[model samples]
Target: MSQLLDVIVAEDNIVQSAYLARLIENLGYRALTVEDGKAALDLVQDSGAQILISDYQMPYLNGVELTQAIRDLDLDHYVHVILITGMDEDEIRSNALAAGADDFLPKGHNPTALKARLRAATRLVQHSKQLAEQHRILKEANDRINDDLNAAANAQRQLLPDIHTEVLGTQIASAFVPSAVVSGDMFGCFPLTDTLIGFYAVDVSGHGIHASLLSVAIGHLITPDFFARVVLKGQEQPAPANLARDLNARFSRSENDDYFTMFCGVLNSQTGRLDFCQAAYPSPVYIGPHGNAQTVGDGGFPIGMFPDLTYENDHMTFDKGGLLVLCSDAAHEAENTQNQAFGSERLEKVIKTSHRIETDGIPEKIVEALSVWRDRIPLEDDLTVVAFRRT
Candidate 1:
């Protein structure tokens, strides 16, 4: 149900105030009559009145003074002021208007003009109420969306591996930073056998909810059980290329162009034999114990894009005291206030010196270096890094 329209009549003349009040009540609005402008203002403030009909001459406060005072009040709704006067002077009308009078009524009190002004005031007040209601609804909806995004982000973080751990004699450390509340990057490291360990990094095609959904799905799909069934061959070493091939076949769709990049590696703990497949992911930096750094991997097709894509397996030796650093594209593409990219050269340089630092701290060191290069600005994309050191 709608609220009643309140019209406050402020006139010192008892006969005139009674007439105006009767007319207002006839128009189906509640009219409150007051003997002076001061009393009218009190009524307006108390009742949240949106229409004020005031006389030009009154005790304590006149019509113009009352209009200005009403305007000064920090009321939520707008008050439509109609100033009534007997004089025909232009200065009087101008003063009333300058003092915030929205309309004017002759002292003779014509019912037709009064009715028209009240109708207009009713329409305006109703419109304002509608707009306020709409703003409230939008705010509630936005709050709900933010809550859902935060919950999903927490779930995504749970899918990631620990920050630092040891698996199959290799010291492993990782870091992940999302550009938004949710991320499109995911990674994991797990022991495939008593002597073999597997690690992989994945970055979906874009940012926000769509990409984050796919990244989370990939995280669940690439578990150790899935690797055992699909990637590991009987009595032979696991082939990362086969995993890449399977992912490509599973996610590729003709309806949409969504896809992701991945870098998968299987390392033999005793021999330090590293077998890897890079699917359009950033080439990893291989740092020798003496700080010599070189990039690994030849570019291959991004997964979930093309069908029948052949992925090649690459091999390298993970010598003792050697450090292998893998990162998402955000590592090198992060830009400073000057818009200069941190670049692959800087990335290699940072990792090259990691041999001097503890293996568990290398991932954080890389992130800190990138933050400095970007001048502490938020990253434009998700940043992820996984580091492995042969002890």
Candidate 2:
């Protein structure tokens, strides 16, 4: 032991107490003599002693009663109680143990037995202290990790466009629900020119911190300046295929396995022309002016996988009073308790029913439908929906 262990001895006989105290000191421990069980408990409580040796008969409290009282105290350290008794009956031993006595010793000056018991008690107390210290450190580390995750989640939310926004006469509405504190999903709608509106919905390969980091990076990179410089070809309108190819080239690396699905588009508000590229993302639903729903986009390769893959551009029309919805796979692939998916048919039906409602309330209806399908179970993946309506 690095330091001396303090042991409390409670006995009414002054001679016996002195004898026990001398034996304790001789065994490389500090002895604290008390005349009664009450005094012994006070000494242990005040000194935070780890060992208590008490005679069965005392002035105020018996050894068994004292052990029970010590066990009830909310002290930070454990006190190993050893009852000294003259009787060797099984009933007495059972009663002492039942009252929280850790060990029992015959009422005599047997230094050998006392020394053995003290060594065992010291080992147990040390183990308990080590465990408490380790628990404190782990709790602090967990709290710090939670705080960082919350901060990152908040910053990612700030990158999202408002729930209801207008860009160049186009009414845009969006909804995002993350399964965890951080998400693998991101989307944005911004104007590229006075007559051109650019938008994108991205889902990183996996969920959690790594996926969220990539999504945030993509959100920061897909600005108007980026579209004018890289996505557009010298005074020409921005090409969706060029944006997909550039992202694939920038993110693909041999050292790491990271890829994402993207739906990138540039809509010409004046001509109602929508040029888009779908990189393995879910096909978007296009609702016509007469409320007829149809799907768009020919599925292409996922970005950031192969180094020299080519993506092609597809086109559609966003005419007056028509609605276009882009959703991540989570919205349709969500499962019920029976393990059945909320497939594309159900998703299209929900959008069709909400067509008469304002564009701002459409995404909420879709989210509510998914929530009811899951029966209140937590989402397994991130869910995101972006809708566009031409007035």
Candidate 3:
């Protein structure tokens, strides 16, 4: 940003060199003079001169040869080289530019004309430095943003359950897809007992890092013996439905007015009982041994909506070889540009139609149904599907 011009003059003719150096000094700059092209090159290297003015014809090294050498050294400072030529030959002009001279000055040109060219070169140096500075700043900002996004993604991944574990005598398989650099969808697994597993899939309001952060908050509440105390505590004979109502009260105190829809359940492997609570989330589907499918439980208000709202629980009996499928609303509500939701009805038909109910097949069939419905449109929100089957 400083307006200081340090120039180097290289002319074999001693008198002409002194005159040019004097002219540069009069323009409020520091001028350096060398008698030959070699000395000019050496002085510019050590002094970091901003501009170089040299005579075309010199002994040992010509002005064009010297310009090429300057470029080969890869000097950091912007050296605006002006080649002074006595001849008006087109060959000399072309060769000067090819050798890396920025401008050409004829010998007959007056001091006034030569001064104008130097002024132009000074402006170019200032502008070039400014552009280089801007490029560095932009790259630094982009790197910081990428680093922050990667950290958020790592935290989001930790919220997911271990798919390789056997819990509650069921094999659990899951798939989570976040629409952006960060997502708001959450899923967790906690062992209620050696033979029982507690799991929940939640969708926080909004998207990106904000939604992902909220999922972490909900994970904090899914404690051990969560069902007996949070769901069935104090009720000498508490129904699964009654337990869900109690949890609704405990989670309703979030500061934000936005709601988080969740599907929570305790699966008892010994008795094949799936005690479930759904609040404004899609119901989990049960695929029978014969492939007959039915949706379980009635849904209540989403958590974090009302501080005093009540929730109801629903119960379902699953036989051996039955599969339970649960997903967020994003799975059903995903649409193409046409604005038509994939809908639960179509989702149900897909499950019942597919005779192959393998562990991986559950999520695959649902995604296939959505892909067809959305016409291959990109997912607009977080999409999650969890499938559990009795071994």
Candidate 2 wrong stretches, greater than 4 Å? 8-22, 31-47, 52-109, 235-238
Model 3 weakest lDDT span, ten residues long: 235-244
Number of backbone collisions per candidate:
0, 0, 1
| TM-scores for candidates 1 onward, in order | 0.82, 0.82, 0.69
The parts of candidate 3 lying over 4 Å away from their true place are 1-135, 235-255, 337-339, 353-355, 364-378
Give the alpha carbon lDDT tens digit for every residue of 127-184 in model 3.
Answer: 7778778877998998998899888787768767764456766878787888887778
lDDT against the true structure, per candidate, is 0.89, 0.89, 0.77
What residue pairs clash in candidate 2, if any at all? none
Sort every candidate by TM-score, greatest first: 1, 2, 3
